[model samples]
Target chain A: MQALFGQLLVGLINGSFYALLSLGLAIIFGLLNVVNFAHGAQYMMGAFAAWMAATYLGVGYFWALLLVPAAMGLVGVAVERLLLRRLYGLDNLYGLLLTFGLTLIAEGLFHQAYGNSGSTYPVPAALRGGVNLGFMYLPLYRAWVVVVSVVVCAASWFVIERTKLGAYLRAGTENPRLLQAFGVNVPLMFTLTYGFGVALAAFAGVMAAPVYQVTPLMGSSVIMVVFAVVVIGGMGSIAGSIFTGIGIGLVEGLTRYLYPEASSVVVFVVMALVLLVRPAGLFGRQR
Target chain B: MSRIPRVACCLAALLAAPTLAADKVSDGVVKIGVLTDMTGYYSDLAGPGSVLAARMAIEDFGGKVLGKPVQLVSADHQLKADVASNTARKWFDQEQVDVIADLVSSSTAGAVMPVAAEKKRITLLSGPGTTAFTGEKCTAYNVHWTYNNWALANGTGREVVRQGGDTWYFVTADYIFGRSLEEDTTKVVKAAGGKVLGFARHPSPGTTDFSSYLLQAQSSGAKIVGLANAGADTVNCIKQANEFGVTPKQSLAGLLVFITDVHSLGLDTAKGMYLTTAFYWDMNDETRKWSERFFAKHKKMPTMVQAGVYSSVMHYLKAVQAAGTDDADAVMAKMKATPVNDFFAKNARIGPDGLLRHDMYLARVKAPGASKKPWDYYEIVKTIPAAEAFPTVEQQACPLAKSASPAVMKK
Candidate 1:
């Protein structure tokens, strides 16, 4: 019974990562309508950037959390302007293919530089240890991750769903020519949305560096699961992606206790079932 | 007419001798292929480093064997059984690779071994640790070097159990290699009168988070949590164990760990853990000399798998040279008869079951304060001799051992 609670909490922690990453995918798809295949690679760069900062520049984890996301967001903007922008006028598959190619190139370069064994990033001094919760020993850092993830999700939701700038952004996505006539730069809005989405992924990566081995392949490992989250949550449903990500984490945790062997595939099984029953996803609306 | 007949006889003898020598080397160039996981979980332990080790062996062997120039080729098996088998088949059928080495993943090795056996080519396995390679699946044309599950189980399990970690829980990787390791360690733990409280089997090759599994082990209240995994999996389990505060309360028994894992984890988190290995680079003067050279080239110390690659390759090349042929049967006999004396193993002999019975070391990870230099990780606890470390012929389940007569099995 205690083990179940512990697993559930661990699941929530994992869900936080899913929630952050899928939220980015959801926002990008909602605004830009292109699946960011390189989101995983971008997340990996976030983790690597944190490690490199600490190793080479003597910057600590807190400073990295502040800097890496902004830096990666700028990278996202450049990618949007230089490469992703060209694909905007083409089919969505073109953008996916280009991003996928970029992912491979980035992963290959990192792999060559750092072998697959990977490097370790120490947990911050402030949140280094765990508290003895009656049900389990919960690491303070994990609790921090869940709390911060929820806050970020809520803040982003407030900004996008209930703000004037967000209204302009949604209008730009819905009717770009109309918004352009209103004297707004629609393409720049698209670029910033992509950048902000990428920044969210980097934030998750920085949070994850202390927990997981900062390996070149870390992003790909979780990216597929996050994609499953996005699909199950409905491609562009922000709240749906956030809730579904955490819910799947809970279900995956329960599966770990009930049937450990199927834990890895249980998410996919749910995704398949969801797809069969609701092709547009539970929260997704038909075009 | 008599002088003409004698001249013709000499001419036939001279031609036949050259033909026989040429036939000794089948393709006129001895080729060795290293089929390994080039960019997966086990790559650091046995990927390019294993290739470098094979190259070093070839160089040390004067780059020639049985009067034929030796060549090397390598491919990434990608840790897939089908990929490994296909590559092995291609290497054997077309490339004329006489021996395949450094099959790191158990499934890949299992897949390739049969293909090698069918093609009648030698396989020198230095990476995979499944005991089945020398037991039920033993092939006449292969050698299982480095270490196996049984040796690791006996060395680490027995020691941990003796130290009052008598109640255990296992967090095992779900794969052939991981399953065999858990099974073997369970036996050793039970033999030492330890109780296995429970185990949580996690998916392998790409399990990033092990906190759930560690939580299960923690709640089980076992004195020790045996990690029946390797490479990154083991490292992650230990790391998370620290994060969840499971380590100081309940100890961990790493059934199969490489030096690279400890290096990756660093001494701070990996300190005071007990594990077993086939070789350590800082063991002796000779080991230091060879390993220094290896480190100079590899930029990191060689793992047991990498060290085993060099030893096994050198031994195989020598057997080919001594037998005067690359024929599988003759080389196997010679390799079995010869003793492997190298930095990796001291005077170890290949058993009839194709297992190189070598001494395994039980080492504890040195604490951060104790480690004075880079890669100085292990504090050697004890040496389990080859005779006691490996299974005897009577104990092994290989049919070859059962069928071979006492005269042939005699060492």
Candidate 2:
């Protein structure tokens, strides 16, 4: 029973990352209508930025935690204004292709500069140990990641659902022409929305730096899993994405405990099952 | 009449001299093709370092064999099997490359094998890929040098388990390398009276979060969490494990950890961890000298793959010198017969299965406080003999083994 509960906790933690990445993807897609293929690369850049700030620049986790996301967010804003903005007037497929190319370029440049070997980033001193939870020993950092990710996801949900700026952003997304007539700068909102989404991804990367090595190709592999999460959650619903991400993570963790061999394939299998049963998704609206 | 005859002879000699010069140039040049990962995951292992190592070996060998000067031409396999095979075909057909070296990926090596066999050119592997290239897929033209998953797992897992770190949990990368290493190491662990408590398979390359997996390991009650992964994955596991404090109480064993990983992790996070490897920069005096020279030129210590390239190329040249022909079968025969002597080994041999038998070592990570120099990471705790490091002849599953006599098999 303790084992089962332990696996469930594991699943939830994984779900947190899935939720965060998928949420970021959904937010970007909802506003920009551009599937950012470079999201993973940008995510990697965020982690590396954090690692570099800490290692080379002598910045602590506190500063890196704040500045890394902002830096990547600025890069995202620049990318959108300089490059992605031009593709907006064209077919959405062009935007997707552009982002894909950007991902390739980003990954290629990093690989060329750093090689394929990984660079390390240590956890902060405060979160460098585990707490005995009676049922199972919980790593303090892991618990912190879960707590932080949940809080961030909830905060994002609240801001998007409850705030005036979020209402304006949503309005701009739904009817940019009308929003423009209402004396609102819809283009700037779109750019900022994309930047915010990228910032979220970068935020996840910073959170992940101490957990995973900062590698050039780190973003490419996880992006596929995030895409699968997006597909399962239905790109239209943010709440649905959050729930599905965490749900899948728990399922994956349980699978690891019960049948280790099938843990990896379990997510895809669930995805297929979801596709077969609902066609759209659990919370996704029908086309 | 004499002047006319002399002028006609001079013109004839000048025209013939052009053909003679062409013949001499062709005879003196020996082309070697380096097919490796130039732009993918394993590029660091075999890209620039491999090319440099091969060049150094050629220069050290006096750059000539059979009175012919050596020339190297490299191609980016791009970590793709089809691309690697295509490159090998091009090298053999168009350039007439006498040898091909540094095939990085297992699938890439597998693709190049048939082409090497057909072309009758020597192919030397210095990177981790297919053990089958030496085992079931053994070809007369191929030599599986340096380390493989089996050697790595057996050396590390067996030693750790025997030393009472028995209960095992694995945080494996979800890929071929991870799966194979975990599967191979599990056998060693079980054989040593250890149980694999559980395993967590994470996505390859870009998986940044191991919190969930480490939590599972922490809960497993396993004494050791074996990382049957390499490169970015291993480093990430180590970093996260430190954050989670998975080490010290529950030991961490890296099935394949390179010196580069140690440098990245620093001795603080990596301390007290055990790992197995085929080569270390500070293993011996000769190795130190070679490493010093390599580091001076490249600004980084040479990886096992880089060392493997040097060994493979040096041995291949020796085999070619002995065989007197670049024919795959002839060269392979000479290679198997002649003992390999290089920085990595005293006298290695190409076994019947085409696997190069050599010593493997088990080392423990030194604490950050214990380090006396930069890049000094591991302290050698055990040296697995060449015969014990690898699977024996009887355990070998090669087709060639079936034909060998029972007496030969016993030896």
Candidate 3:
């Protein structure tokens, strides 16, 4: 039972990253209708930005948490306006290919600058140690990740569902022609939405800095797993993505306790099972 | 008029004579290509450092061979076998590269071997993936200059089990490296009267969570969890193992660990873990001095792979000078006969299967607070001799080993 609880904690931590990255991916897909292949690279950039700010500039984690996401969002805006905007009217496959090329270029540049060896990012002073939970020792930084990710996911959902700007954005996504007819600058909305989604990815990257090293290819490693989560959750619903991310994380954790060999492959197996059960996904509407 | 024409002819002959003499003295420059994974998994081991090591060796040898300047060029194979093979072909055909060094990744090296054979170029393989390249597919041109799975497992697993940590469970990365490492280590464990309770093979490259693997190991009741993986996979497995609280109960033995991995993991998580390697930066005064020099230039400690690159290149240059030709077979014969002396090793030699016979060490990670400085993580426990650390020639299943008369080879 103690081992089981420990696995759950591990699951939650992984789930937090899943929720953050998948939510961002879903948002970009919803607004821009382009699967941003460079999403992982942007996430890696965020971690690198945080590490550089801290190591080179002596900035703390708190400042990096705010600044890294903003910097990445700015980069996203530049990419959307300068590069992605050109492919807007073309086939969506073009966007995917273009973004993949961008991913390669971005990853290559980072590799040129940093090489392949990863740099360490220490956990913050306040959250450096673990707390004894009787059943298992829980690292404070991991708990913090879960709390922050949940809060961020909820806030994003609230803004998208409740706010007037979010309503306009959703309207723009559904019927850009009609939204533009109603004098809502749909193109600008699409650009901002893409920027916001990238920023969310960056935010997760910053959160992940202390847990993992800041590497040139760090994003690519985890991005596929996040994509798997996105697929299992269904690309259609935001809330579904959040729930599925956490749920899968827990299931993965439980498998670690009960069946360790399956832990690494369990998620993909679940993805395949989900596809068989509901091809569109658990939360996706049938096209 | 005849006397004036004779003087003009004499002057033209004098100019042509000097040009012909100069051409005889210097036959252009010798170009060597350093091909390896530049941006993928093995990049830390064989990327920029491998190229830099080769260049440094060339520079140390005065940057000239056969009275001509030497040039070093490199290409990123990106860990793809086909790409590596194709790159080697281009380097040989288009660039006229005489030798190719540091082919990292076993599959990539396997792919590049035939290219080197066909081209008849001297291939000093310091970082090629597996021992099998030298053992089974022993090419006359290819010189396996460093350690392999059998050596690594022999040094770590056999020694560890013999020292009393007997029962084993493997958390293996599901790939060539992991599979080979586990297979080698398991043989050592069983030979030492230890039993493998069970093993779990995790997917390579993309695995982020390792809780399940750790849990299974924990449940198996094995005394040691042998991690037969490298790079981010190894680091992640160890990190998640700590999270799952499996380490204190079951000992974790890393089949392969490098300085870079230690730096990323930090002393806190990695403390008390035992691992084996051919090189450690703080192993000795000589090693420390050499590593300090390298760190000053690259801002990173030299891994065994990087050091292997330096040693292999230096030895290859010497062989080329000795043989008086750049032919693969000639250079390889000279390399085998010659002794390798470097910062990380002394008196190393190429074995029958092309393995570099050198000492391996068992080291334990120190606590973060125990470290006197940053990068001070390991404490050496044992120095494994070259003969014991590597498989015997008889045990080497290479066709070359089988065909060769062991009587004359015994030194």
Candidate 4:
């Protein structure tokens, strides 16, 4: 049905955000064994950065597309160096609590500066409208978001699974203490891996800015859902996050079509069910 | 934090001492506190702008009432009722705030109204929409100003139904505000010979996606999809509805909307949508002048909430001056007896049930091309007078309505 296809398209778009955010989370967890709860706030700041660029500097969305991630990665470097690096060897809960605290601080600063009235970042002139595909009408901006997020997810997957750096990263994940003993500079790796993860979050935020209202709470609204996506995909698996993110997004889209009111809760229900069966996530390996 | 700034502050106060002393204000200082959502969803609608408008009213009144200095204090309620109650308690007890104004959310209004009633302090609500605050939840010394759900539904509902668009589907946010909006609009719609197809309830304050809800509304085949939501929820729903192309087939009626929302959603998507509002900055020369002053300070046009705060604060101070006392009962009686004439409202009066029955405008969003300038968003479709816009005497079951009798109301 046309409705089904349309929702599927929507699901894919939402999946793109989930895939990108969770992929970042998974990458950080894989390298540092710390659940970076501030991923959503980082993504939100990326959008704000894009908005600031456009509003103050006359930088367009495309330029923002390239500039925001690299800029937020720098922020990530500072965050990891000054704060996150302190809790490197502590219990994972400390990182979670620390990042969660950081998220509150980041979101709180924006909230204080810009009230909850959402500001719209206008869709770029080039991707302002949509085209009718064979089955459904697809907006150019949304399509661009899906394509770019998938491409990034795939490229990250390839780099992590295939490259020597990825091999070093994976081996570092396996035995960071030994890797540091063998002159791998594991601490710097931890910082870069954390930076790279948060950069991915910022990348998603830039993509999301034009679509959703760029409010401080925008990240919090969907952060829980994305965390569910990461959990359901197996915590640290790269490809697992991508597939499960897209898959859950589609399921979420379908639920919207069938039971509209449950759309927000459907992903959590799926996560609960998946946890009951798999114990890990759908793509996660058993410990 | 420094002695220099402290000295500067004291010097500024000292400079104002001559004006305060010479103004012949009663020797007692009357302190007014503004409690609102400064950091939450309704922040921009009535937050700091409303506070600024209140100060403007005080300045226009020579910043002195009843031969005393009129002081202002404000705190963020964070959109929580408990926070509102605690804040109101602090203002009323510790700070000696005589009146609290510009409470934004119904949850906070509802929470703080009782506290104000217990304290016998005047509470003026400028931003909340639920009339339940005036109906079953009515309390003494509390006035619902600017607008409420009944007025919004009555204004938008009657027009949409009269235009031969009868069948309705509602996408209501799930909350006290949204529920009351739905209830009020349903009454108006059925009264106008319209029938409801069905409705859906989206989670309040958190819903970002509305495609599924819009799709459901689309499938209902209703002529109109009424949005019983406010703030960001309404903006998101309307924007998504535009993307979903539901507008050409089904007219989307924003039951409660703010000028801030219109500014956020460019005229392109918001064009042709019907909304009812109590004030627009460009509605008249007086409004334009007052709003220009407001815009100078805030760098934005005043919303109805901000305008209402100015008008209500002006009315409260004048009542206090007339009664020659800061006593809540005396000032409230004077406020009720006096008719309001301001940039916000002309000949508006507080009814027996403590609802300020001001005229509401049913305005249609102007097309992007038809708009000549920024913030020129609305084309007034109809002006529903106070009598027609608000509920009748018999319709209001407010306990206070029984004793006072709305004979004070003018047709």
Candidate 5:
């Protein structure tokens, strides 16, 4: 029983990552109508950015949490203006292909520079150890990850769902020409939205740098699972992805406890079942 | 007069055929292909470094064999069995590669060995530390070099158990190589009068977070958590183990670790761990000399797999020279008959089951304070002799080893 509780807690910690990444995918797909295939590579770049900042400039983790996202957000903005902007009126597949190509290039460049053994990013001195809970020993850093992820997810949710800027943002997605006639800059809004979503991925990357080895391929490993989480929650459903990400995380944790070999495939199994039962997804509107 | 001349011509052609066949280097050149993980998890241990080592061996051997210029080719198998088999098939069938070397992933080695055997080419494996290569899956055209799971399990498992880590639990990678390591270590642990409590098996090649598995191992209350994985996977597990505080309580035995892993983990976290290795670069004068040369090229010290690649390639080239031909059978006979002596091994010889029996070192990771220089992570605990290090020939399940007795081979 204690073991099961411990697995659930660990599952929730992993779910935090899923929630943050899928949330970014959801926001981009919701507003931009383009599936950002390079989000994983961007996330990996985020971790690398943090490691480089620490290694080269002696900037610690706390400063990286603020600076990396802003820096990666600028990169995202440049990508949007230079590359993604031209592909907007074209087919969605073009966007995916371009981003996928970007992913391969980024991954290849990093792989050449750092062979896949990966570099180490030490946990900060403040949150280095764990507290002995009755059921498990929970690292303080993990608890911080969960708390911060929930706060970020909730704050982003409130901004997009409740604010007037969000209303204009959603209005642009509905009809860009209509919103443009109303004295709104729709194109610029989309660029910032993409940048903001990318920054979110970078934020998760900074959080992840301490826990996992900062490697070029780390983003690719979890990107597929995060996509499954987004699909299960319905593509663009903000709250749905957050809840489903955590829910799938718990289920994956339980599977690891029961049958560890099948844990990796468990998320896809759920997606298969969910799609079969509801082709539009649980939270998706019937388009 | 025409019939007499034709008979004389036929006799003269027949006499020249024997001389022509004596020094037949295939395709007028000898090519060696290194099929390894060039971009994946195992790339650090055996990818580009293996290629450099093979090239160094060729250069050291005067870059010629049997009056033919030696050549080298390499491809990334991507750690997929199908990719490995297809590349091996192409190299043997079309490229005229005399031997394939450095198959790091176990599944890749398993896939390519049959193709090499079918095409009558030799394979010198410096990575892929699974004993099944010499046991049920042994091939006549293959030589299992560097190390194997049995030697690792015996070297680290028995030593830890004797030091009072009796109860064991494993966090294993769910693959053939990982499962074999776990099973071999379990036998060693039980043989040393230790009881295994339980285990948790995780998926391979993609698992980034080991917290869930480590939690399970922690709750089992076993005295030791044996990590039955290698390369990056082992490095990740050890890092998370320290974070979760599982290290100070239940010690970890890295069943299959490489120098790259220790270098990645650094001494602060990886200190005080026990592992078994086939070779260490800083062991002595000869090893240091060769490894320093390798370091100048690779920009890092050579792992055992890389060193073994150089040794095996040099030995293969010498055997080819001795036999005066690149024929697979003749070279195999020469390699098996001659004892191997180099900086990597003093006097190791290939057994009938295709395993190269050499002494393994039991090493403990040096603490940060104890480590005086970079890459000086391991303090050699003991030198395990070749006899006790590997499985005896009679114990292996290869059909070719049916007639051989349990005796050590010496030059």
Candidate 6:
């Protein structure tokens, strides 16, 4: 039972990364009609940004937590305005390919700069150890990650679902020309939405630095799984991506508990099952 | 650099090296391509660091061999076997790269050695650990430099079993390299009269979360947990093991570890762990000198793989100088005839099977306070003799070594 509870905690922590990353992907895909393939690279960059802060500038985790995302958001906006904005009228596949190319270039540059064995970002002093829950040791940092992830995910969903800004954003997504006639700057909305989505990815990467080693490939490693989560949840549904991400994370943890060998592929297996059961996804709108 | 005229150099090299097409490169130059994982998991151990070591070797060797300027180049294999095989092909076919050095991961090395042999070019592997390199996959133009699975398993696994932490459970990265590591270490455990409890194989190379895997290993009651992975995989496993409180009870046998891994993992999590390695930067004055140069460039102390690159490239250049020819077979013959005593390996010998015999160290990670300074990680507990560290020639039964003496052949 102790072992089981421990696995559950692991599941929740793993779920947080999946949920956060998928949420960002869902938002960008919904608004831009372009799959942000560089989400993973942006995530990895976030960690590297934090690592650079701590290593060179003596910036600690708290400052990195607040500052790294904002910095990466600027990077995100630059990418959108300079490159992605040009590809807006092309096929969505072109956007995927371009972002994918950007991912490769970014990852390659990072690899040259910081060879891939990765460095440790020490868990901040405040969240150092864990709580003995009588059944198992519950790591304080992991619990914090889960709590913070839920709050961020909820905040993102609430803003997108209930705010007037969200209404303009949604209207722009539906028909940019129509939204523009209402004096809305649809292009600015697209740019900010893309930046906001990228910031979320950076936030997740910052959170993951201490949990997972900060390797350039960390984003590529998890991005595939996040895509699987998005596909299973529905490509454009905010709640769907969030819920599915955590659910898959738990299922993976359970698989690890039940059979360690199957843990890696269990998420994909669940994806296949979901695809078979609901071709449109659990929350996807009927095409 | 080369005193010879361009046209004359092409005809001369082409006559002596028929394997390379005459039109490849006309200049009297020896191009050595350092193929390694430049952008992936194994990069830290052998990427730019390995390239720097190769360059240092060439520079130290007077930058010329047989009146030909030595040119060094490199490419990132990205940890893909197909990518490595293609790069090796292109280097051999078009680039006129005479020798390739530092094939890091076993998969990349395995994919490349056959290509090198087929092309009649020499390859020096500085980081691969699969025993198949010295046995089934042995090639006339290939040398498994520094260490392999046999050395790591015996050096670390035997020491762990000897310490009475015998019963073993393996948390392996599921793949060719990881499987081979676990299999080799398992043999060492059983040979030491230790019991093999069970194992849990995790995702290969890319796995980040290891908590569930650690929980299973912790609950299994194994006295010692063997980590059959390298680079980032190994570092993450050890770190997560500490977080789950698994390390306090059962010792971890780091089946494959490098000094850089300890630097990333930090001594707090890696302390007291037993590992086997070919070189540690602080091993001696010679090692320290070379490592300092590497550190100046890489901003971190060298891993054994990087050190191995220096020694192997140095030796390869020496063999070329001795033979007075860049012919693959001739250089290989001179290499086999020579003995290696360098900053990394002490009196190391290349076997007929293409495996190099060198002293392997049994070391324990230093506690936080015990460490003298940054990168001072290991306390060498024992030096496993070269003879016992690698598999015997007879046991390997490499076709190339079938006629050679079973004993260590010293020049």
Name the top TM-score candidate.
Answer: 5
Q: What 10-residue stretch in candidate 2 chain B is worst by lDDT?
A: B19-28
Predictions' DockQ, in order: 0.83, 0.49, 0.35, 0.42, 0.86, 0.62
Clashing pairs in 1: none
lDDT of 4 by residue, A1-287 (tens): 76777777788888888999999999999888898889889999999999989988999999999899999999999999999888977999999999999989988899777767767888899986777675555668888988998899989999999998999899997888888888888888888998899899999999988878888988888889888988999899888889988998899889867887787889989999999999988888786
Q: Model 4, B1-411: lDDT tens per residue?
A: 789999999999999986565344323679889898876778879888888988998999999876679998888998888999999999888888888999898888889999999999999989898978788888878999899999999899989999998999999987788899999999899999999998988887777877767767877789999999999998888877776667777899999988999987888878888899999888889999999999999877899999999999999999889977787887888898988998888888887788898889999999999999878999998888999888865577888777664454431
lDDT of 1 by residue, B355-406 (tens): 9998999999999999889899999999999998998866779998888888
Model 6, span B1-411: residue lDDT tens = 465687788888778785463323235788899999877788777788899999999999999877779999999897889999999999989888889999998889999999999999988989889898889779888999978988899998988888898899999988888899999999989999999898989887789888888877888889998999888888988887777677778778889998878887878878888889898888888988888988897898988898899899999988888877787877888898888988888777888889899998999999999988888899999989999999987788688787655453444
Better of 3 and 5 by lDDT: 5
Docking class of 4: acceptable
Candidate 4 deviant stretches above 4 angstroms: A1-9, A56-60, A89-105, A108-115, A124-140, A232-234, A254-262, A265-287, B1-29, B405-411
In model 3, where do residues sit more than 4 Å from their true spots? Answer: A1-13, A56-67, A123-148, A185-188, A228-236, A243-287, B1-30, B93-95, B282-293, B366-378, B405-411
Tell me the native contact fraction for each prediction: 0.81, 0.72, 0.39, 0.46, 0.83, 0.75
What is the alpha-carbon lDDT of model 6 when measured against the actual structure? 0.87
The per-residue C-alpha lDDT of model 6 at residue B170 equals 93
TM-score for each of the candidates: 0.96, 0.87, 0.85, 0.88, 0.97, 0.91
| Tens digits of per-residue lDDT for model 3, B1-411 | 899889999998997985554332123667788888778867876788888888888998999877777899999987788998899999888877888888877777888888888888867777744657666677767777767888778777877897788999998887776788888888889988999998888876666556656766877779899998887778877776665567777788988887778877778878887777778888889888877877888878888888888888888888778866555666677787777887767888876667778888888889887899867878888898888877676676677756757652552
Model 1 error, position B360 (Å): 1.0
| Collision pairs in model 5 | none
Best by DockQ: 5
* Model 5 lDDT, residue B117, Cα: 87
Query: What is the lDDT for B19 in model 3?
Result: 53
Worst 10 residues of 4 chain A by lDDT: A130-139
Model 2 misplaced stretches (Cα beyond 4 Å): A272-287, B1-29, B62-64, B67-69, B75-98, B105-107, B129-133, B169-220, B401-411
The lDDT, on a scale of 0 to 1, for candidate 1 is 0.92
DockQ of 4: 0.42
Which stretches of candidate 1 lie above 4 Å from their native place?
A: B1-23
Candidate 4 chain B: worst 10 consecutive residues by lDDT? B19-28
Model 3 lDDT tens row, A1-287: 77678678878888989899999998888778888888899899999999999989999999999998998999999999999999989999999999899999988998888776677787789876667787666667888999999999999999988999889877876878998999988888888988998999999999988777678888998888778888888874687788888998899888776876677688899999999999878787665
Quote the chain B TM-score of every prediction.
0.95, 0.87, 0.89, 0.91, 0.95, 0.92
